[model samples]
Target chain A: MFEHLHAGLLAAVSMSNLIALFFGTFVGIVVGILPGLGPMVGMVVLLPFSFAFSPDVALSLLLGVFCGGYFGGAVPAVLLRTPGVPSSLVTSFDGYPLTQKGEAQTALSAALLGSFGGGVISVVILIFLAPALAHVAASFGPPEYFAVAVFGVVLVVMAFREQFARGIMLLGLGFWFSTVGIDGTTLSERFCFGTLSMQNGLDIVPICLGLFGIGQTLILVERDIMKTNDIKLSRSTLDFSAIVKVLKYWKTLIRSGVIGTFVGLLPGTGSILASFLSYDVAKRLSKEKERFGKGTPEGCLASEAGNNAVPAGAMIPLLTLGIPGDALSAVLLGVFTINGIYPGPLLLVKEPVLISTIYISMLLINVVAFLMLIIWLRPFAMIVKVPGKLLAVVIMVISMIGIYAVNTRLFDAGVAIAMGVLGYILLRMGWPVVTLIMGVVLGEIMENRLRETLSLGDGSLGILFQRPICIFLIVLTSLIILIPFVLDIRKNIRNKKLNQF
Target chain B: MPKKDYYSSRAHDLLGSIFGVFALSMLITSPWQVDTSGPDPFYKGPLIFPLIVFCLMLAGSLPSLWRLFRPSEKSSWYLDGQGKPFKTMVILGLLIIYLAGIIFIGLEVSTWLFLLIALKLVNQDSILKLTLIPVLVTLILFVIFKYFLDIWFPEPLIMEIFLE
Candidate 1:
């Protein structure tokens, strides 16, 4: 391990790789700080260039973006009450409150420090645990894969417990969308409705840009962007004391990091879930729970730490099983495939040095991005003062161009605009758009794996229950689904008893 | 009951039922033809997942539809803040126009025009700043996407005529 780290360090320090890392991190920060444009869009925009660069350089660039984007989102969340990325929504629950209380500098410092710590811890886990996890993943077959995919869908539904029905409905909608293209086995089109472009199926790029980017822009427009009050930043600098103040929440940081890494290991469960779960856990465990949404440093620490850890955790499934743990990692899979670096169990065996270099690069990216953000903290705070109308125009233009640039197809731009309209309607109707996107991401995998499992079993459904791993996953999924209901029942009974007394 | 409360109360169920009808139509109109010659003929069809999904959609919508007819707590129908309907309509209309313009006039010109119009609608800023900002931003984006990344934007009919 030490020897591998040494080799990785040497490779990562190369001039070209260093330059890629710097630029990737810079683009990531810019994309993340801008509302509605998350790391996924940034990576997608840069994906075409990955074909021109070496695998190490390409991977470094994307990883830098992935890391920097997660931390960069906290800037707007803390200062402007607008989350640059969905994962930072939880951060703003406390971060924006801190800003309102004239503690924006403290909140920013805490978030950055928490992000750095979580990033480092997650990398250490990746370095030590990924190889062993890959070994276990190597033993998995179609039935196990099918079970894990089912577990992912269920976990996503569970994440939106308050809106379970809406989540499930959106998931169904996503599944329907996934079935549009030519079937892998039969080559028969499912739901193209006679349109030739529909036969190619909907691309994730347009869906993301439409739902997250354009949809968000429309909502912002309705909110009257020009009328929003400018946020005033406190005059205090993020000094040594602020750093020390954040370090006091070390326990929250570490716990959130662990939770994030584990949740991130699940296929299709993304960083948003990890952050929300960590925030919930932190609030539940804190003695001063009443202070949770009211400018508590611990709350910000938990959310920032959890979200920043997700990219490393997501790498586990992508590297070991060739399956992406989340949408962002799914895009990374495309980058890997384009660069002729197929990620599977053999990837580690064939390119151990390259993988190690990626790990080293991620570690370096976290530190470099943190320092750069701290140096430019004041400037970023001032970005919130930019008129919302200008921001909306820029976002709309970028989203349109970015979607069109993917395949140079006007039809894709149409698809994006259509999805944007649908997304806005769904948002107004109180539906969860993330679930729909997740369903689309996981649907193909589930269908392919289920078909494979059935073929292996000669059409016997019993085979799915026969494997120990499959059974374990089934039981786990059942528990995840049922526990909330049981808890609800217990609460109801207790309330009734108290009323009788 | 107030008109807003009445609409808000029925919105979820109305939307759910509409979605259910759409799902049913999709399931019924599925175009996948099963390959009976294959060894696993039944499993080879592409419509199985879609069928399951549509069924789930119908199932999920049923409860909401049922609740619509039953007495329920009052809910606000207005999703956005009051007096913003005009702004919402204009923004959506602008988006639709932008999409059409992209196909008709090309991405660069349409994007520039869209930005100017959208900014004018939302802000009282000087015409120069709006024009310059959009022009500058568009040129920068065009260079980065076209020259650096090698993305090809479709040429408008006017440009093609001029070139010819």
Candidate 2:
């Protein structure tokens, strides 16, 4: 392992590989600053170019894009309040507030440093523990997967503080949408309703654009119309003392990074949940919990580190088990497929060098992100000062055109618009759009796995319980779901006692 | 807690009842006939999942509807129909029209017209910015998708005659 590590580091330092890292990270930052474009789109768009380079160099370039893209999202999220990608939504909580308070430099610096630390730590985990983790993941069967999916649904219920019925409705609607394409087992179209585009099912990008961009932009327009003060850029200089203040919270930083990597390693659950969970955990543990929403650096470390650690964490399940841990990793699986590299049990023995190359590339990209942040902090901060109304129009138009360009089908644009309206209505009713999105993406995986489990004969649902890892997952999920309800009931009882007093 | 709370809860009760009934009816009336003999023989087949989901939907709606009628301690988050539903309805209607138009009028024209109207709808205050942005965007997108990305779009009827 040490020998492979040395080889990987030397390979990473080659002139061509270093150049590839720089180029990928540079493009990633630009794409991250732009709204409605994400690492998946960036990867898919660049897939064809991979044919032009060697496998090692291509992997280096793509991993560079992945690591750099995660940090890049912080640029727009902190500066423009646009949340350049979905994972960055958590960053906007303290990040934007810090920016408004004229500490844009401090906020961005904390985010960059936290992102770098978390990413490197996660890569280290991947390097040392991936084969062992893959052995564990291989033991997981359909029933355990189903239990995890149920845990994801329950997490959505707890996180979303709206009427439970509406949230469930969104889940049901998403599940129904998932059944639209051809049934994978039965080979019959469930709800194509005569359109070929729907036959492939709704594209995730179009659905995402409608829910977040168009739906969100409309809400932004309404807010802007009602808002009193225009968006103002902060003029605060970066203070060295502020950097030292964040360093004081190093324990919280490491804890959040570990939590994020663990969450990322979990199948189906992704960065969005990891970031929010870290925020909640940080708040619960902090002496200044009440100050979290008001630009606390501890809050920044928890969320930024939590989200940034996820890309590396996501690669764990993908490289080891052939299961994608999140949406972006799912696309990376496709890239691996295109390059004739099957990422499963055989990957460790058959292609150990390739795996080492990816790890080395991930580490190098974090350094690139840090350097980019230092040079471009002020220039990037200027993004928020773009007039809100103008920024909105650009987002809307780009969303419309980008969705249409995917397959050259205007029907997709229609699907996006209809969803946009539905999303707007759901927003008015206080339903959680993010939970609905999670349902849409994860529901199909859960459904297919459930079907597979039930198909196994001899009534051995106990087959799932046979494996120790499966048993552990079942116990853990039960605890996660039940503990929340128990806590909620306990709080209610305590509140009743207080009221009586 | 407030009068606004009472009214909103009542409204949710009504809306949930309507949606619940609609969902149940769709389940019953949906054209899902079970064919058992294809590839896999299992108890929990394709139709079973849909049926279970429908049952869950109806069951979930019952408690919410009961709360609406009885006014329970739970708070409701519904706002009182704040924006005009009809304007959104019109935008949806135009989108459908644009989809149908794509088969006849082709991609560029329908896309151009759809975006122009969508821009107008989103930014009603700035006509000049709205008009200028959409046109420039459509052309630039045309270049990116057509020349650079090299994906195929339906050629306009005029371009089909002239360029071909």
Clashing pairs in 2: none
* Model 1 spans with C-alpha error above 4 angstroms: A1-20, A31-65, A76-107, A225-256, A266-303, A321-354, A493-501, B1-9, B31-40, B69-86, B160-164
What TM value does model 2 have? 0.74
Reproduced native contacts, each prediction: 0.54, 0.25
Error of 2 at A451 (Å): 2.7
Please give the TM-score that candidate 1 achieves against the real structure: 0.85
Per-residue lDDT for A1-501 in model 1, tens only?
678878989999999999999999987887788775568667755654555678899889988888989988998898887887889999999998998888887888888887888888888888888899777877888898788778867876777776677678888998877777677677776666677898788877677667666776776666643223465555534566787877878889899998888878876567888899999999999977999999988888999899899999989877876667666786676667646677767787788898899899999999888987877776755655566657666777777777777678878888888888877777666576767877776677778887788778887768988899999989999999999999999999999999999
Candidate 2 lDDT, tens digit per residue, B27-73?
Answer: 88545533344655554456545555556567657866776667756
Candidate maximizing TM-score: 1
TM-score for chain A, prediction 1: 0.83
Residue B99 lDDT (model 2): 59
DockQ of each: 0.50, 0.33
Worst 10 residues of 2 chain A by lDDT: A225-234
Candidate that scores best on lDDT: 1
TM-scores for candidates 1 onward, in order: 0.85, 0.74
